[model samples]
Target: MQPTKRFDAIIVGARCAGAAAAMLMARQGMRVLALERGAYGSDTLSTHALMRGAVLLLARWGVLQRLVEAGTPAIRRVTFHYGAEAIPVDLSPGDGVDALYAPRRALLDSALVDAAWEAGAEIRHHHTVTALRHDQTGRVAGVVALDEAGREHAIAADLVVGADGAGSAVARLAGANVQEEAGHAATCLFGYFRGLPDTGTHWHYAPGAGAGRIPTNAGRHVVFVSVPQARFKAELRGDRLAALRRMLREDFPDLAETLGDARPDGELLAFAGRKGFLRQAAGPGWALIGDAGYFKDPITAHGITDALRDAALLADVATEGTPAAFVRFATRRDDLSLPLFRVTDEIAGYAWTLEEAKALHLKLNGAMKREFAALTAEVVS
Candidate 1:
């Protein structure tokens, strides 16, 4: 087929990773196009916590400042409770910078898309990629997409980035074997709370197998409970929200009580996926970023941070004379993601234990506080 069209890059999925990647490349003078199935300013049931490291990356992108001005605030400390014992980690205010800042996902993602658009990357919203086209040599040369009106169209590019998130079609198209780890059927229930008990926007890690609350801006908080598939079924039986709400009251009363007063400000969210990965993050002319590559349990609240990191590294590596930029991007991702894998693995193991839970909770609480402080200061989450 003739070259459909050409540009420096065509980005699929305009969330944080895609938008940031598009922005970075565009700022460097490349013509970039970003396609997002989701609307620019819509809300999502996302666990929008950014670790300190991810927080720092956002600052460099210029959107961080906008978020702050929009009333997004820093979250300094994380507290843990196990067996009536409380472990509070000091997330002191910015000694000049706070390590972590919390914002709603709608606001966060919208800001990112706006930044990409402002940087000169054209965005096609409500467009869904239907298929990917590979050249005879097997490089991803273009994508076949359906716009909001369902018209099929082809767009070619030097590179096609798949930031389409967990259920990424690009990863599959690139021959990356996506697999869910065995025995990893962890079901999650989460949502934002508007009115909570006088809880100081501090993340709360409760006693039990696993229960927690992450605070965010504008009186928004994310509360969730992770349970085995069997337990999840047993608890929900159908009324998942009721089961989840009951879980909070009984197993994590402190958080439950706070949320009990909380009005559901957004959709109640559910996450049912293995802490999974794509065996290969790229091939030929294509690459995967963010949740499209490595996605772990929300237990560590690493989603946003990981997305920012993925975007930053992609900017430097996915550039000129690099046929292997995609591979390099994947490699850099592996290097960064491996540690996170280990950390999440440990957290998962510890979360399943009732006896060792307290010690592990305290240890993690301390780490989160420090990390959170560092995040607000634009250090790293």
Candidate 2:
């Protein structure tokens, strides 16, 4: 059926990247539609840590205050543990950002969705895209989606954005190629806990394992462990929680001691590990953002930040509504993303010794600094 209504752009996912893009575009007075497959404000598996760049964007877009008002803890300092030596860094006030945060996905994604809706974007929750519709010229012009009631609707738009995630259906439908993929992957097992001491963010690194304790909303901390995928599969078998506990006791004994009697608030979650990739960013009337375009292992915990960064970049050009502008968006996105991607891949490899891991982290820090600088200059200017 032909679409009875049209939009300037239709976003395939309404999480971080898609919702942020829709909000930006709609704020600029473009007609936007965002389709989400999940229930409104539903939670998803995520480390959910926001880097400085992401915080800057959220602040600029007027969404950070909502997160703050929702009682998300402010992360003012971060400690790096290298074989029992702790190096704590206090975040100084700069770039209009005083502190960082780790809001739950339920809160962060819903906040962006609400912001988009308030900015005049049409948001459809529990809507799954079934197929892509193309114009006669073979460029993606719209999509056909199944609503919550199982009714199908064809929607026309000038562009279709793939922000569904690493397993993005829109990217697959659009034949977005995998441009680059990491050779190594790490499995991450994490869970939330209450009553743990809130000490900002703590990252512990040993020879071949990594763990972190991140403070989030409701006075809970997310503690996670990352190990080589092969070891996780061969050693852990089906008992992830036990393995996580053992690792915490053996590799991160200090953190385990701090855990004291703080039992898990929820079930343990696992990302079994998949090779991270950078996919084709844009082609014709379809474009990819967030994990749909570039995904790295959760070991780095920079996924959401990258998603917000690319969403802004894509929206800046996508509003122009032309193929050349999309190409420009891709180029700019790559210029900003490639360095951090390389460092993250190396860290995710889990092939480093304690000293090597420290060096890699330094490199990662440098990359993040450069990213923050670039985003501040461009977005704030």
Which lDDT values do the candidates have, in the order given? Answer: 0.70, 0.90
lDDT of 1 by residue, 28-125 (tens): 78889998998878776566777666666777667889888888766666666664567666655443346567688778888988888888989989
Q: What is the lDDT of residue 109 in candidate 2?
A: 96
Q: Which stretches of candidate 2 lie over 4 Å from their true place?
A: 237-239
Q: Best candidate per lDDT, number?
A: 2
- Cα shift from native, residue 270, model 1 (Å): 2.3
| TM-score for each predicted model, relative to the true structure | 0.87, 0.98
By TM-score, how accurate is candidate 1? 0.87
Q: Please give, for residues 1-381, the per-residue lDDT of candidate 2 as tens digits.
A: 768589999999999889999999898889999999999899998978999999999999999999999999999999999988999999999989999999999999999999999999999999999899999999999999999999999999999999998999999999999888888889988889888888899999987889999999998999898899877886576666677788889899988788765778767888889888999999999999999999988888999999999999888887677778888888888887888888888998878988898899899989899989989888421
Each candidate: RMSD? 3.7, 1.2
- Which stretches of model 1 miss by more than 4 angstroms? 1-4, 92-96, 178-183, 197-208, 238-241, 349-351, 358-381
